[model samples]
Target: MLGLCMGLAGVVWAELPAPSFTLAWTHTIEKIRWEEDYRVTPSGLLLGEARIKGSGAGMEIPDGAELREGAWHYQSHLPPLQPLRLGRTPEAGDYQLCIDQRCRPLGDWVGPPQADRPALELWSCETGSGAG
Candidate 1:
């Protein structure tokens, strides 16, 4: 089993059962839906795949991406991310975190967004120490 930590500024707020999961949201600027699939590993989180409903500013279709079912999909070749930063704002809407085919608002895991702490950090719990 893999543990995922959700936190703000090095203070953990929650942990989730994370063998693999998907993080999805609508682009604040383009309003297009985007989804990324990630696999939890001992070292970090591996970005396995990504898909976008449409392309717009900052949403360029990457090389090797293929259009399928009205969306662009591609595999991510980047190195494992030790910590993935997600910026949260009341206006931008909640990020959907999907695990085991069930989706919920990210706040369901990390608690409500704090005005002072504007970013939520996610990483494999094996990689860092934080109280939950």
Candidate 2:
């Protein structure tokens, strides 16, 4: 009985499935794009990576670029609050192929994951709300 009780407790504390989703944003004038693949644990910890793509002027991803409160801010080495030209590069795999401190967009899941993909909830700072 005690063992069963402990097992139940453990199950109660089991981590929640990470929320899997893809995030994206872009700016045409800057010719830059940004997309991030992330998984958020039930504890609210988000783990993911991103890729940046460019067309005309080349993609520029600043050092301080980060996703804070659901907004990608290319703050360093780029303008503030501007889109980072989000895109995907299947060739780069799990890394950003940067040349001259810049690289074409790398692996960033777009559209949807798979047919069996989990539902996605998009959080937008601009809207200050989440949408499915």
Candidate 3:
């Protein structure tokens, strides 16, 4: 009985925190806009451009530059301001995105970037609830 209990505990330890809803990767915008240049440090954080595609005039951004970036929120924690560069494209894949300081359609992405194939699925837990 003790061995079985230990085995169960191990499984739980290896599991990631459960999320309520999973945010699916709808599309990738091919470049955004930023008025001023931003910089973020390296503390397990990434700095790049957020490319959003599909809009009325073909493509558009919140501002009107080619890159715009705010604090990236992961799960519910905001590390630091990461630099938002231009040109670099994130590989397509499912990622967990959450709202942080700045509010926008594309939220901060979690996990490694994926390719343009295989729809990306982001997970998030509902407020005042647990993942069952």
**How well is each residue in 12-120 modelled by candidate 1, as lDDT tens digits?**
7788767799999999999999999999888888999899998889989899999999999999998988789989888788899999878899988776666776889
Choose the strongest candidate by TM-score.
1
**In terms of TM-score, how similar is model 1 to the real structure?**
0.90
Q: Per-residue CA lDDT of candidate 3, range 7-116, in tens?
A: 01112111123221122234344332222211222231222334443333454344543422452222223443221112212553223322233322232232233343
Superposition-based RMSD of candidate 3 using all C-alpha atoms, in angstroms: 14.8
Where does model 1 exceed 4 Å of error?
Answer: 126-132
lDDT of 2 by residue, 1-132 (tens): 000000011122111122344444454456355655544332322424555664345565556666565544542222221111222232222223232343432223223223332222222111112211
RMSD of 1: 2.4
Locate the minimum summed-lDDT window of 10 residues in model 2: 1-10
Better of 2 and 3 by lDDT: 2
Q: How many clashes (backbone N, Cα, C below 3 Å) per candidate? A: 0, 7, 18
- Against the true structure, whose lDDT is highest? 1
Shift in Å, residue 81, candidate 1: 0.8
Please give the range of 10 consecutive residues that has the lowest summed lDDT in model 1: 123-132
Q: How does candidate 3 fare on TM-score?
A: 0.22
